[model samples]
Target: MTTTPNPTLIYPPKPSILFTNIHFYISHKPFTSSSSPKSNSFTIKCSGNASSDPKNSDGGLKNLLSGIVDERVDELLNREENRVLLDGLDKATQRVEIAKRELAQIEQQELENKKMKEYINQLEIRAAEIEECQKELLEARTLVDEAERSLEVEIEDKNSTMTETEREEMYKNKERFESVKAASVSAIVGTLAGLPISLTQAANTSQLILPSVITLISCALFGVTFRYAVRRDLDNFQLKTGTSAAFAFVKGLATLGGGPPMELEVGSISSHAFTGAVYISENLLIFLFAAVGLDFCIKLRILSPFPIETDVSTTKVD
Candidate 1:
């Protein structure tokens, strides 16, 4: 060869072709001596589908590797231990999520407890203020009660001093009035008693004067006696009746003894008894009239019901 033959270039297999499922078979033989010089030859055979196109070979190799890897993963997952490990991993993830939720709830509970404590503290403060207000009210009430009692005592003392002067003034007026009333009543009643006797002796005016004077004096004295007698707390009707009767009987006895002279006669005892009865009966009617007049005056409120001294003394006790 004058010029070196052009060098042949052979490229290596692509990565995809290397991973493809391909099988190769090779056979070698030596030539026999009778035929020619010794020489060796090979028969090459390939198994499985191998593409000649580069793009197709790469795609087919990629598909074949993907399928084999999937089969191997399936076989590994089909084992019981591997299945249990996967299940355990899923459960662990769920437990982590649950723990995060519980932590959030715990934080919320703490916040609620803080709020409750603050509310309770406010209530305690309010209760203390109420107690203090109650204590102040009680003290104020105590002061008011003491002031009222003191005012009452002062009023009572003033009244006691003032009443003494009032009583003295009242008693003086009553004494003057009572004396005048008693004298006026006695004078009028005495004049009425003398009128009947004076008319009988109307012929001699000088003779009428003595009897009239005597009757007037006796009636005046009787009024004084009556006033003293009734001063005692006794029944009005009984006292008036008894006083009138006694005065009438005394006047009758006096008239009987001091009458014109009479000679002794038969049946003198009966005559004296009858004459005494007649004189007593006449005087009794006049005294009874005076008693009734005084009682009427009392009922009409013209006279005081109680004795002057006794009434004044009993006022303070009442």
Candidate 2:
């Protein structure tokens, strides 16, 4: 095998450079020495023969083959063609900076327009909410009006008195009540006076239908008679006790000026009516005897009171 010798390596001299800062500025920030990012220093680095070194033929030969010298590079910088190319490059850089600034302004305008559109949408939503609230308010007002009308109609019906058509039924009930009451009184009086068992008592003992018949008959007569009263007596009483109280309460609501009295007459009326009815039902014969006793006292002039007016025309509006 044969070995070949390695060629000797040669190195050219390294270049020297000079820098001249054309426009350098110092910032006013405290204790900061930060340099600008843009390089404004003119570089004059070239492999030229201006070095003060010892003459060496081998080094000169290496530099000849390496590159151009510093003098030639300076001459190229001053050439007309190179100067025009540099001017063109500088103009292009300026145009690029203007384009970047315009792009930033356009982005800012687009962001502002987007924010305005969002604000407009919010305003529209608020308007819609306000309109909905107004509609609800109008609906509530309409409902309140309807309620007032219904309440007024109910008040008129409750405060009004009996009509002419109801008087015929009232008279019939009055006739039935008078007949039954008279018979009951007579039967009780006779029994208490030691008279013989009457037909009514006899029927009640034999068949249990007499008492039931009397109860139903009295209820039918009194129920009809009490619906519309010509008088506030036992035969004609306020059956709708709660409703009458409610009517009076509604009338007494206006208490500022001359409103009606706040006294609840229904309590007194209901106490007398239901209590009297219950007392009679406990023992009809005893109730009749009591009535006879009261009548005897009154007829003997031992008891006298104010006269009661029961005619339909005698009713007062208040």
Top candidate when judged by lDDT against the true structure? 1
lDDT of 2 by residue, 256-302 (tens): 12423334688866655554444333334333333444345335543
**Deviating ranges (above 4 Å) for candidate 2:** 1-68, 161-318
lDDT string for model 1 (224-288, tens) is 56666776443667888898889889987787778754558757766777788877876677666
- Flag regions of model 1 displaced more than 4 Å: 1-180, 231-235, 260-268, 315-318
What is the Cα-based TM-score of model 1?
A: 0.41
* Model 1 accuracy (lDDT, Cα): 0.67
| Model 1 clashing residue pairs (backbone) | none
Q: What is the lDDT of residue 119 in candidate 1?
A: 100
TM-score versus the correct structure, for each prediction: 0.41, 0.30
How many residue pairs clash per model? 0, 1
